[model samples]
Target: MSQDERPALEDLLGAKHRWYHVVDLAPGVTTPGWIDLRPHVGGPQLPASLQGQRALDVGTFDGFWAFELERRGAEVIGIDVDQIPPPDTPQSRWAEVQAELDGAVPGTGFELLRRWFGSSAERRSVNVYELTPEAVGGPVDLVFIGAMLLHLRDPVRALEQARAVLRPGGRLVLFEPIDRKLSKRSEPLARLMIGSTIWTWWYANRACLTDWVKAAGFTDVEDLGTRDVVDSTGNKQRHLTLHARA
Candidate 1:
C-alpha cells in the first residue's frame, strides 16, 4: 500500500482491539492483533483444505476466520452483530476507535482487509438468535463458532440456529472458554455467568458445553482438549474446542 492508504487503514482499526488472529494485511504491514490463531487453522480439528465446501463463520469479528476459510478454498460467509451500527446512547458499546473515525462503519476493518486481499468471502450483519437456514438462504457444509458463545444470553438457541444451518452430517466446530472445575461432574449442565461489570453471559463447563451441543441436535460430539490463551494482560485462560456433527 502507498502512503495515502495508511491513514484509512489506521482509521479502520478499533483502539481497544480484542484481536484473536494475527493478520498480515500487507507486505511488512500486519494488523497489530496479538493472538496467532493460524496454528489451529489447518490442524486435525479445523481441516486445512476446505476446497469446494460452503462454510459459515458465526460471530466473525474482523473476518479473520472467514478469510482463512476462503484461503483454504471454501466459499465463506461471516456474520456478526458488529456489522450493524451501535445506538447513539451514552452507554452504547461502541469501540473508542470506531467513535473516533469519520464515517466509520461497524465492519470497516473486515472490509478493508477483504478489499486489500481481493477475497470473495462475504459478510453480513446478523445476530445469533436470528440465524436460520432460511435467513442464511441454505444449509452449509461447515459451521464455525469461535469464542462467541459465552457472550450470548441464549447459547442453546444459538446452537440450534447453528444446527439449523448445517446440511445433514455437516460439521460444527466450536472453540469456547470452559469452567474447568465443573468438568469433574457428570450431572447438570453448569454455567457460570460473569458479574454485571462485563458483557459476558455464561461460561459453560466442558461437560455442560458438550451436553448443550448434543441437545442442540448434534449427533456426535468430541471434546478436543483444553488449550490456554493469553490475554493482553498476560493472563492465561483455558478454552476447550469441540467438533460436532449435525
Candidate 2:
C-alpha cells in the first residue's frame, strides 16, 4: 500500500458499480457519490462517538453510514437487499420495474469501499421489513435509517421493525426527505404520489414524519431541523433529521 502502488481512483471509477455516498478511501481518492454526506458525519443527525455500542444501519446502500458508525467506534451491521424492491405501482408496471432492477448489482459499491477502508462492519443481505432481534443477533444500541422511508410502501411497519431490534433506551436516528412548504403547517400531512415514479411514494412534511416515528413506539422524539443535500445530478433536496429513544 505504498504511495507508488496505490490504486488510482480514476481506474476504480470505471467499474460498473454506482456509488451513492461520497467516501474518502485514500488521500485524494474519494468516490464520486450521488450524495455527499461527508459534511454531516459529525452533525446532530449522528453522534460524534459510538464507543462500546452496537449499531444497525438500515438500507445501508454503499455502506456510508455503516462505515461512519464503525469510524465512531461502534460495531456496525449494515443491511440491504440484493435487489431493489419494486415501487407501489400497478401490477402491470411491477414487471417492467423489476425487469430493469434485475440487472442491478446491489452491494457492489459497499463491498468495494469496505475493502478500501478495511472496515470491520458487516453487510447483511436482509430486507428492512424482515428485521428482528434474532436476525441481527440481538438488540443493538443504535439504529440509523436515512432517506429510505419515501421509497417504502409501508414506512410505519419498517420503522416498527427497526424498533424491534433496538435495545430499550437505545438511540434511533432517522433522516428523510421532507416537503418544505407542507412542513410549515401544524397538522401532520403527507402527500401521496404513488404513480409519479417507480420508486418514490410519499412527499411528507416534518410533522407527518414525526407522527410515523411516534406510531412506531419511539419516545422523546427531537427534531434536529432540516438540511439541504445536493445529489450528484446537482439537485438539492431538503431533508429532516429526527432523533428518538427506542
Candidate 3:
C-alpha cells in the first residue's frame, strides 16, 4: 500500500472493536490496545530471539506477543476461545457477565492486525483446556501465556494443558497479575476476586503463582520478578513473570 492510501491509526482506533494488546502495525501507526506490552518485547520475560523455534501463544488477543515471537523468527500459533467464559463466581453473576461479553467477537482484532503485519503466524480457536499436540498441529518448542491465568476457573489445569503441547524440555514463559499486598508475605497466598466485573477469578501472590507452575509439572522454575504497567485506560497494574521448563 502507498503512503497516501494508508489508513490513519486514529481511524483504526476509533473502530467499534476492542483491542487487548498494543501492536505496531506500521511506522508510527500503532493500535490503541488495552495493554501495551511493547516495552517487554526483548526483555527477560520473553526470549530475545526465537530463531528456529516453534511457539504457542495462549489467549493471543490482538496477536502482540505472537507477532513479536514471529518477528524473533519463531513459527507461531496463537489460540483463543470463540466465547469468553464467565468468572468462577455465583450462578447469579453468570447472566451479568455473559451480558457484558455478548456481541463481542473474539479474534477480530487479531485477524486485522495479522493481515496488516503480513504475519504468517496462525490463529486457532482453541480453549486453553483443550490444548494438545493434536489440537494445535504438533508440539511446540515454547509456550507463552500472558495475563490469562487470572481469568481461568482452573488455572493449574490450564497450565497442565499448556505443558501438554510442548516438546520435552521445552520452555514455558508466563506473565500474570499479582496481588501486591499478598506478595509481601513469604508464603503462597491468593486473593479471591470472584466478584470482579471483568471476570478476573484470582489475584495470586508470586509464591502462589510459582507453586502453580511447579504443580503443573514444570521444572527449573524461575521467578523473573514484577513490573508495573499502565493499561490504555490509564490503570496501573503490577504483574509477575516466570520462566520454566517442561
What's the ranking of the predictions by TM-score, best on top? 2, 3, 1
Give stretches of model 2 more than 4 Å off: 1-11, 84-90, 99-102
lDDT, candidate 1, residue 204?
A: 82
Question: What lDDT does the true structure give each of the candidates?
Answer: 0.74, 0.83, 0.83
Say which prediction, candidate 1 or candidate 3, comes out ahead on TM-score. 3
Which ten contiguous residues of candidate 2 have the minimum total lDDT? 1-10
**TM-score for all models, in order of appearance:** 0.80, 0.90, 0.90
Per-residue accuracy of model 3 over 81-149 as CA lDDT, tens digit each: 875443344577767767777778888787777666667889999989888899999999999998889
Per-candidate clash tally: 0, 0, 0
* Model 3 misplaced regions, further than 4 Å: 1-15, 84-91
After superposition on all CA atoms, how large is the RMSD of candidate 1? Answer: 4.8
* C-alpha RMSD of each candidate structure in angstroms: 4.8, 3.3, 3.3
